[model samples]
Target: MGTATPHGARAHARAQHGTRTPTMPVVPATDWPAPPAGAGPLVWAETVAGGGYAHKVLARGTELRLTDLHGDACAHLVLLAAGRPWERFNAADTVKVQWNAYLRAGHLLLSAQGRVLATLVADTTDGRHDTLCGTSTLVLNTERYGDGATHCATPAGRELLTLAALKNGLDTRDLPPSVSFFQGVHVDANDGTLHFTGSAGPGGSVTLRAEQDLVVLLANVPHPLDPRPSYTSTALEVLAWRAEPTRPGDPLWDATPEGRRAFLNTAELLTCRGQS
Candidate 1:
């Protein structure tokens, strides 16, 4: 008698034979844990496997959080205004405007127009995030690993982001400089060199609140600065829910003079564009 086939093998056989299998939604089942007490209604939830990517156009005020499950995922991020793709996240502006290279709970992600795109509402990584080192490229990963094509075992973060961009009506030229979370780097004060610090272990997370109707692209792949010889990364959990946008009197908006200016500029643009 023939041995029993594994369930996944059976499913693959059916798919190869043209048995229609529709793509599944990102929502979780009823048994999943509910959102925090005042987080508003849950809007999206999904787990991105290593070397994978996710993208969505979220409305203003939605709070999105990324969790480093199993302690090894590097989440590369790119933000763009939903309708105006050219106005996108400016990493240099973000660091220079704030006068800080390390980002945390209160820093605002800004665009070149001086508009606030999102606010870092929570950070549990103890400063394990990066603005200097961007995601991995095909050539870099190809040199490190044997193969770096999208179809290979270890795909480059740039390839993943390119695919995600295409799905959102964008191309390589529209892709902007990205910020990374979970893994980080620090400048050596003595020599002014850079050093890589791996993740902050499991269950660490960072949350951001959207300040505009934004396009968020994320790729979970090994950090380009990672010292590991073999390509490796773990899973990442993403959850977004409805929340209120920042108001003039919000503490975060008034945290600093420069930050307030950015917020005011954001509000001015929103009002002129007929958004409340």
Candidate 2:
């Protein structure tokens, strides 16, 4: 296993694996730099409405709680290691690593380098975590909702991601692929076709435990699978609190022995490059 380079360090895993190759991979011009600011201790949170964007550098051992204030809400998430933005969440790897397509409790969000970014510790959904539906774009939103919608409604998911990334010392190009929570998708095995349907009922929520210090970008725009009568957005809230320190016997570590190796790699990487 290999760790990430911090603040302004070289990426070491993308070539062997198809991880990100960024223009500013070593150091993004963001407010928070890897060795950590050391100015403030890690304790913070915020609530964002639907059609909103949020970005934060979440510390390791912290838990991020996302709540769907409304029943029909969707939250798209993009995650990257704080030290190495290039090492981002690999959805394909995650689906395959866990041997399950539907993201639920106990599923670990894997990075392209096979390291853990975050772990799904708890969820309040109807088991509809989706990766296939993708995100909504301005053009597509207009096409689906009509010309009036383009002008009246807030920006779609892509724009929201871009804006959030920029605020966090990243460009639109730095935005990682996203996972749409509270959205569901199923494939018609017989026909080999896929269909998007279902929701987590009302007040659905998910809790993620950060295994690595991370740059998290979130958008509360509608999911691509969403086909409501017209354009509708839902409000979502984000809460970050202290997470119990992870030890060798931690369930997530014990469940997936590989996860332990990944976390060690991240810890070592941060320790080394973060000090430089």
Q: Please provide, for model 2 over 1-276, each residue's C-alpha lDDT reduced to its tens digit, 9 standing for 90 to 100.
A: 345445223344444453332211222222212322222333544556667777788888787777777766788899998868888888888888677778878778888887778888888786777866667887887777653232246568887887878887888677666888887888787995778776767778788888788899888777777767666777776666666535566777777656677667656765686621
RMSD of 1: 4.5
Give the TM-score (vs. native) of candidate 2: 0.77
Question: Residue-wise lDDT of candidate 1 within 115-172, one digit each (tens)?
Answer: 9999999999997999988899999998999877777889998898889999999999
Model 1 residue 153 lDDT?
88
Where model 2 places Cα greater than 4 Å from the true spot, the runs are: 1-42, 147-152, 257-261, 267-276
TM-score per candidate:
0.90, 0.77
Candidates in order: C-alpha RMSD to true structure: 4.5, 13.7
